[model samples]
Target: MKNLFLFLTLLVLSVGVNAQQNQIQQDSTSREKLDEVLVKAVRVDADSPITHSNVDKEELAKRNLGQDMPILLNYLPSVVTTSDAGAGIGYTGIRVRGTDATRVNVTINGIPYNDPESQGTFWVNLGDFASSTESLQLQRGVGTSTNGSGAFGASLNLLTDAFSKEAFAEISNSFGSFNTRKHTVKISTGLLNDHFEISGRFSKIDSDGYVDRAFTDLKSYFLQGIYKDGNTLIKALTFGNKEYTYQSWFGLTAEQLQQDRRQNPYTYDNETDNYWQDHYQLHWNQRLDNNWSTNIGLNYTKGKGYFEQFKEDESAAGFANLIEDDSDVIVRRWLDNDFYVINMNTTYKKNAVEIISGLSYSVYTGDHYGEVIWGSDLAPNTNIRDRYYEGDATKNDFSVFSKATFKLSEAITGFVDIQGRFVSYKTNGINSDLVSFITDAEFSFFNPKVGLTYQANQNNSFYTSYARANREPNRDDFKNGVTEHEILNDIELGWRHNTNKVALSTNLYYMFYQNQLVLTGGLDDVGSPLRATSGKSYRLGIEADASIQFCNSFSTSTNVAVSSNKNKEFKASIDGALVNLGDTNISFSPDLIIGNALNFFPAENLQLSLLSKYVGEQYMGNVDSEFSKLDSYFVNDLNVNYEIKPKKLFKSIMLSALVNNIFNKEYVSNGYYYTYDDTWSDANAVTTIEGAGYYPQATTNFLVGATLRF
Candidate 1:
């Protein structure tokens, strides 16, 4: 604690010394005036018309740094985060409104990025990938039809760095709470007299995770080579790698967790894991006519890695694990993926009937390898091979969509959007154990959506939309033992407001699920998890977000979400009172989640800022019972910078530093009891005998860094 205090004191002193010196000539607060800074972050893709929100490179840097993409996205109105590693920076998750990430579609350059088999995005697997993202867009609801992955919740599209003109270089170092440190380096070389450009970036991040053994050592790089000229552009990109200390999915035993509170809370040990992914992309953009543009994209990803750990028991002879001695269960896996997509669209600005149309096609080929290193269930402790289960898969996605804007009148403008999609999925090459019976299946899906938005005033707009989303069962959802299906229908209504300074947006969504996967309170061999299909489930919620620009050098942003989501939950088996699913609130669903940031610039050469973050109470299961609730927590962050002007023969420079979690606070992001039944005994009724019970958050951390650019 003393060390932490001293670090903080030094940070404050540094900021005070380098802080910006105000310019007295400017009449800012004294005179009433407003300045405008128009944002050019929006992308000009072909024929796609949609309501989109974007964060530019500058905006991304202003938020937190590192691989926790969801943390930076928390300000989006209809978003919430989940974490097992206490601090939101390490191991965390985000849900769009009420739908989990599986329903949240993600794309890069119009190509699918989700794991073809799992459909779940484990961002932790990407390491310091955020450092490479040049710009990103988040489209809420069924706003527009894009390529690949089902967009039930929302869609996020990202574009990496394009080519830059002139030679430049940058270096940034930052440290914050949780012993988190990030080091970055970037260089760009403009060649061929502005006809060609090349750039690359390298980043490394290390942290003693919030959870014991939950540490993360992430390293990655981005390299881009581009060719551009009037009417034609072509580019190629390669990048990705991530490694983390394993916190495993296993939760804490209620007794052990309560007694220790600081330890891993799990029985298993020696589990540090590594994950890596490499992507190669080729893209071409061509302008064929005055109002026509087209883009063709091709990409491939090679993903291979695993999280290894020690197991408690050897034989699965029965549910009783006490019969055997503790053992080591090494779970290994590797995956290779390739994708292709092509899209074309045209636009016409003539008259009130503005027309936009487009067509897109996407395909994916994915393969996986799974093996068990040490398991008594196998013959005489012999290492397991293909017999354990591994396989290959191929899937195709195609879509056609169009939108037309019509100025119905001067007070209100309206637009109509429609889209159709066809999806076919298949997997094979291994028996029921490796490829599994689940892999022998073949399925198809047709998704359609439509929507409209009307402006009531300059600051207010109302919109409504409906969409049908179908998901072929994922690899886990297809287990041979007992697997079912997953499909969803979503309808949304919302309002949006924007002005010169402050902006507010709210959404109310209703979702229906068929053959929804519900937790059977089961565990996989590696402490992952298992779920079975139940009849139905739904999530309804209200979310709001706002941004206020108080003045040129000052701004604030806030976001909050509240909702109830669940399987066709039941209050009583006998009474069978229809559970609202929206009543008790979904497991892991928090009643309130909020984040706020303030930026203050005291002088032309200096800037200072303070940030506050909060997430409300939440539960661990469908019942929303007493044992499943997670307590709320809050934290603070401070940032400061000073510009150094050089004289005569020198260049200019800037120094910056950040201090996070002013004071260490003990907390947990997620936890669950092993059993949910009515057994109330001491010997057999331990709260967390099996399931992962708790994941810890980060403690007090201090880091000071600087940046230099030329």
Candidate 2:
């Protein structure tokens, strides 16, 4: 308690130190404005009263070699990332502010990246995307109104690389533990004819994951063209990836971990998941006059994937018009989806007021089906292509939003935002057991936001904001009989201080949820989570992060978050009886998260850094039972890089290395649990039994790489 008080005191003192300095110059227009068309509709201004973080290309290149995107963002506040391969290569997941990936709104150049059916981002589909990204922004709560699904937890928007004026070529390669390797080639045909430019990149990554038989083979390409003339700018981009990975969804239990941590239950050599995704986008930007601008974008995405598994002792009743005699079998499930979108925005900036408005329409069509590969049925006439179950889903999303910011005084500014959304969803499907189902639903929502920012001085400012967010459930929720959508009322108060020697940001937030969909830690047939709605829940937290530059050669950055997440009047069905379990902790919501990075530069071309992370204890179920608890853990890593500019042949040469888990800490980042009744007990009473599964992390690992640029 005393430490918290002292920390708050220091924060206030830091802001007050510059009270005698000059008052900051107020600008009607944002200084950090981007020139790209796709980002015009979703990005927030530098002076906007919102909590956000921006990562540029230079920072991304420091860690962009082999790991997935989530691994690159592990150092952010209130973020927790895990990899199923026990290394940072394949099948990784991230949670922000205790909310899972499904709740995070993700976009690529203002186009929705989350699956329309599942509402989740699959980073594997865009392999090595960081290599082609120009900048990205992460908004922590329900921020400014944006495209795609609702922002229940956080929103991430990425802008691809822009045109270069000078021709360039580069080659990069990395090899590390688990026989992992990455190869990349990039080239640019800088400003041809002084009006057009073309650039492209190709990447191939392969890894033998830490988990037994878990491997990934991925290939990707990115191509783009830019045309700029006078007041008009046009951009065309095409990017995609093809990936194949060995199945490792089934996790280990405590007993199995004690025996062999690397054991995989399935012995089949062909068990794997294969997928491919492609995206095409075009944008046009036009400037009408000195105070007006407009942008329009059209995008299309095609995705298809299938995961194959081995089933043992399957029942014959599950198949349609066939008998398998309860023999071993192999089966596969497939998904093919297409999405189309059109987005437009107009901006007017005059005097001390700025107004921006946008409209978007999107459509999605997805097909889901399953096939049986091999079985004991001796019927040679059966067609192998016949699907036992087939389903189709179609959805349309339409939304309009407007935002206005006006100066209330020389040092105060006010912001207002409003958005309206309409959705129509329809699905008809046959379950694997041949059971049929259909659903047709429509929903409407209106969200509003208001905020005020007070600029204290040239180096300090304070802001407060209130926002309302509503989110509709995904396809799985509909299949599980959930009819109503969720709502959140969020309030945030923050302060920021920046100077030549230090930078600091602090926020206090309260989030109230109504019918929030919470994780149940149970897996569905396709290995994804099955979620349930909690009647009432709330989260309150404090977040603080800062960077200090002690001298020319030493610097450090750190962030810490503390929060309490709880369910009110929780109840569960146990042993065929409803048990009232009063107020309890929300599952998978940790109370504390911390991250730190310390850097040292001994020479102009050499740098070293140490990274550390800590996560508090978490529960797998809402009841807070001892059997469902996961202990807290801390982990650290060391990274070093050296670069040299040659006078003769190559332009620049660079070498980098990373050592993860330097102390070899053993910990579990994620897990699930289930309880069932054992009716074989004495008399007529029923006994309960529980089972749990955990995904343990790898110990010590290393990766090294080299790059040559000309």
Candidate 3:
């Protein structure tokens, strides 16, 4: 730790000496006149008084190997990442400001990516997506209005690679610990006859995870075509994912972890998850005039998947027609869903004011069913086609929003945004409990936001904003009859300073929630989530980040967040009784998070970096018991990259290596806890026993890669 501080000090001194000679420059002449159709609907304009960060392709390429998107964004402010495979490869998840994935809104271009029912972004379904992305923006809190679900916590918008003016081809491959391997191929036709361009990429990745049987096999592809004219641009694209991974959801208990953290609880050979997803999108942007611009986008997605699990000593009566034979069973749960969306945005800009309006309509249809594929010898007549339950769900959503920005003065700006949304959801057939039922609901919401930005000077600025957002319950919430609209009132105050060598930003936010759906670590047989409202909750935090350019070849970036999350008068169900836990800390919310990166270029073509992260302790249960806490951990990584200009054989060649968790620290990043009644222990009474499972992280791991471009 002392050495790290010393290095930071020297770097800062070096940066001061070179400040007058170095300045980040922007080329306005090369900027696009019209934004991509998919992103325009949700993105914020300049001087909008919103806090956001943009990540470009160059930042992604340094570590673009087999890891998922969440792992790549792990160093961002207020972000916590976890992986079920014990490594950053398959089934990874992220939480922003302690808010889980279900609350984070994700979009590709401008199209929604979260599952309508689960409200979760499955990055595995878009294998190697980082390879095709050109840029991404992350907005924190109840940010600007967007399509599909609301941004209750944060929003992630991704833009695919743009058309290249020059033709190019590239090949990349990587191999690493845990038998991990990745291969990718990409090409672009550049501009054809000065009017059209085509680009495509194919990728495959495989890994034997740190945990036993946590294997993953993934394949994906992306293809896009673009047509451009003087003031109009049109694009069409398709992407898909195919994945098969063994079940690693069942985590470890304290005793089991002590024996071996990598132990697998279940010994079934066929326990695995298989899935595939495909997406098609079309976008058009037109510059009607100097003051008017419009964008339109249409998207369709198809997804199907299933996970198989073995039940021990299951009740035979749960099967459709099986008798009570007191035998074990193996079952599979399947999901097939279809989603359609249409989004449009129009912007009018004149003088110092800009007005932008957007409209979006989306529909989703999903089928959920379970089948008993195998049975114990006592019941030998089982077949693969016998189903236990079948259910269907459909949702229709529509929204319209308008935002106006006005320049109040030479250094001050005012903004206003209003949105109206309508949602209708219905479900029929059997639920997780095998109970046949039918339910339907509708909701209407109006959200408003207002803010002001004060550009005190060229190098300093200050901003503040207030916003309100409402969200409807998801499928899981409906299954348990907690279908109430969740509401949030958010406030933000921030300041930013920028110069030739240093940039700094600090933001303070307060978010109040009504009837917030909080996770209880409970899951259905199929691993679908189950949540309950906490009645009242709030989160208050301070976020600060800074970056310094030491010289042409050296720089450093760091971010830190401190927060307090709490539930008012929390209550829990313990052995069929309501237990009040007064003013308890919210589960899974850490009070402190810190991230740092130190980069240096020892030579003109060689670069090296060190990344560090620290997360504070968090509780897994609302009661905040010591037994349910995940201890704080600090981890670091080392990265190196070298580039070569081989004029004879290839246009350029690059090599990269990443050593993760260099100290090999043993830690648990995530966990789940639940308490159940043990009536058998005392026939006349019930004993409440608490059970917990921990997801241990990998120690030291490495990945080495090479890229060839021509």
State each model's CA lDDT, in order.
Answer: 0.61, 0.84, 0.85
Q: Tally clashes: model 2.
A: 0
lDDT score for residue 653 of model 1:
63
lDDT of 2 by residue, 87-170 (tens): 878788888888889988998888888887789988888789999999998888888888889988889899999888778888
Candidate 2 segments whose C-alpha is farther than 4 A from its true place: 1-34, 378-381
Ranking by lDDT: 3, 2, 1
In model 3, the Cα lDDT at residue 673 comes to 77
Instruction: Pull out the clashing pairs in model 3.
Output: 38-110
Tell me the tens digit of each residue's lDDT in model 1 across 509-626.
7777787654443455554445556567777777677788999888888777676676664442212233334334555556666777777888897878776667677666555556
The residue-by-residue lDDT of candidate 3 on 613-637, one tens digit each, is 9999998877777878899999999
TM-scores of the models, in the given order? 0.80, 0.94, 0.94
Candidate 2 TM-score versus the reference? 0.94
Residue 5, candidate 2: alpha-carbon lDDT: 43
- Cα lDDT of candidate 3 equals 0.85
TM-score of 3: 0.94
What is the Å distance of residue 221 in model 3 from its true position? 0.4
Model 1 lDDT vs. the true structure? Answer: 0.61
